[model samples]
Target: MSKAEIQTTGFFTEREFTCWRERDYKNFYPCQVSKQEGNYVSLSLGDMSYRFDDTIAEDIARCILDADLVTAGKLYGYIPKPAMRESAFDSWYKMNSSGVWNYFGEGEFSYYRSGGVIIFMERVTDEDDTAEIMGIYTIDDVGIKLVLESSSYSFSKLDAVWLSNALMEALGEEPLDFLKTSTM
Candidate 1:
């Protein structure tokens, strides 16, 4: 949220992702590295949190990173970037100009797990047109598919970035640096 937080939460380091995975799937308490006691590293997720020894902490991190790579892969696929600028622009214009805004033209990227795999779906609707891209990945396979609900429309990359950042934050990471511009 703050500049400091952004600096600390920059793109998923293997360590951060591992930490997130541990917390999300294993229900390991989220914690920040604090101090070290011989072979053990102390961690505190929050006030009144339990401290873990180094061995347990390492085990938790390993479990988190070891979780099926499907979810992580899907997450990576949703990072909207320069390549998607044109599509994003087109979608924004259509949504704004079309009278569909009165009835629909809403955009959303919903994430959930099904059958032990993670699914990330982007649904956008405008009047008679709709575009949906869904990313489904599991430990064994990964795929990104387009499902046309009606006519056709483009998904907004900006929306994708927003959704991606939201997911990262939800996983205890910092917001993305996609839009940040250096003043110098």
Candidate 2:
């Protein structure tokens, strides 16, 4: 039997959205392009779902940032080679979060803190390309920040595609081509 080296505590992945239904002010949704409405972003995970106007770029950023880790871990778990998980860990840890900007439309950023998990999403109001992502470390109030560990642009891009598709699949829906654009 394979043992999970990663300890289980209050930490959760985006896939664990089902278990968070009872929690107040907590979100477990995934990001996706919406088909029911034009220029909208649909975030769906398990049975819980949220739809937002494309104009709310900050919300979209939160969804994307929040789901990145879970998606990366899932991808690493699927590789066929030995020690692949470790490789994924190293690659993920090597990513730099310096340029990351979580612009929340000129001081409109928000965070969700619950069950030892913290997600920070900020977006610059004028800049369309920059967003900041900050997440709490999975220990007992050590106050460690999760650094971006995406080794390369390709890695980040791959993870984004996986996230978009995973969210769509989890919703029992087909993936759409273009996600709604936002400027928040």
* 1-184: candidate 1 lDDT, tens digit per residue: 3435534544221112122223235332222343222443322222322223333333223222222222233446431222222121122111124221111112233334445323333333444433333221112122111121221211122222332333344344554535432211
Worst 10 residues of 1 by lDDT: 136-145
Q: Rate the local accuracy (lDDT) of all candidates.
A: 0.28, 0.31
The lDDT leader among the candidates is: 2
What's each prediction's TM-score? 0.24, 0.24
**What global local distance difference test value does model 1 have?**
0.28
In order, how many clashes per candidate? 2, 14
lDDT by residue for model 2 over 1-184, one digit each (tens)?
1112211311112322211222255433342323232443444333333433333423333334333433334345421221222110112222125422221111232334334323333333445534433222211111112223111111232334344454443333454324432211
Give the deviation of candidate 1 from the true structure as CA RMSD.
Answer: 18.7
Runs with alpha carbons beyond 4 Å of true place in candidate 2:
1-33, 57-160, 164-184
